[model samples]
Target: MANKKSTKTPAKAKKSDKKPGLIARGKAYMASVRSEMKRVVWPTKNELVNYTVAVCASLIVVGVSIAVLDLVISEGLVLFASLRG
Candidate 1:
């Protein structure tokens, strides 16, 4: 007896072949976002303020570090060029 292969495609494969329309896809994406947002744990007002302050402090520190590094490298390059001439 010979084994025969099944000819039927999966239900999912047939549906997957045809994509949802742009408006339908957008609506579905927005619905999923709303569902996820509903499950989110929101920070309290104090927590939000603390987070903002932490972020601003971090930005200031990073900016100052980059500026210092730039100044040091530029001055070193100028000193090296002067020594060569």
Candidate 2:
């Protein structure tokens, strides 16, 4: 069998072989992305509302917990600093 001669150089061969024009490929990619996005299972209005309220309540609880911890730590640091002075 005869050996096949490569027409492409090493650098050019390393790049993508299936390179299409930018605009055409971008439009095709966007069309595929839109179709895939349509397949997503979005939450209903009631479920969305419930999730929003749950997140807000958790945020408030965490905020208060952090504030209380900050106050306790600040007081302890101040007391220790005063004793050292």
Number of the predicted model whose lDDT against the real structure is largest: 1
Candidate 1 lDDT over residue span 23-61, tens digit each: 999999999999999999999999999999999999999
Model 1 CA deviation exceeding 4 Å by range: 1-23, 83-85
Residue 24, candidate 2: C-alpha displacement in angstroms: 1.2
Which ten residues in a row are the worst by lDDT in model 1? 9-18
**Residue-level lDDT for 12 in candidate 1:** 66
lDDT of 2 at 43: 99
Instruction: Look at candidate 2 and tell me the lDDT of residue 68.
Output: 100
| Superposed model 2: Cα runs more than 4 Å off | 1-18, 83-85
TM-score, cand. 1 vs. native:
0.67
TM-scores for every candidate against the unseen true structure: 0.67, 0.73
As a whole number from 0 to 100, the lDDT of residue 34 in candidate 2 is 100
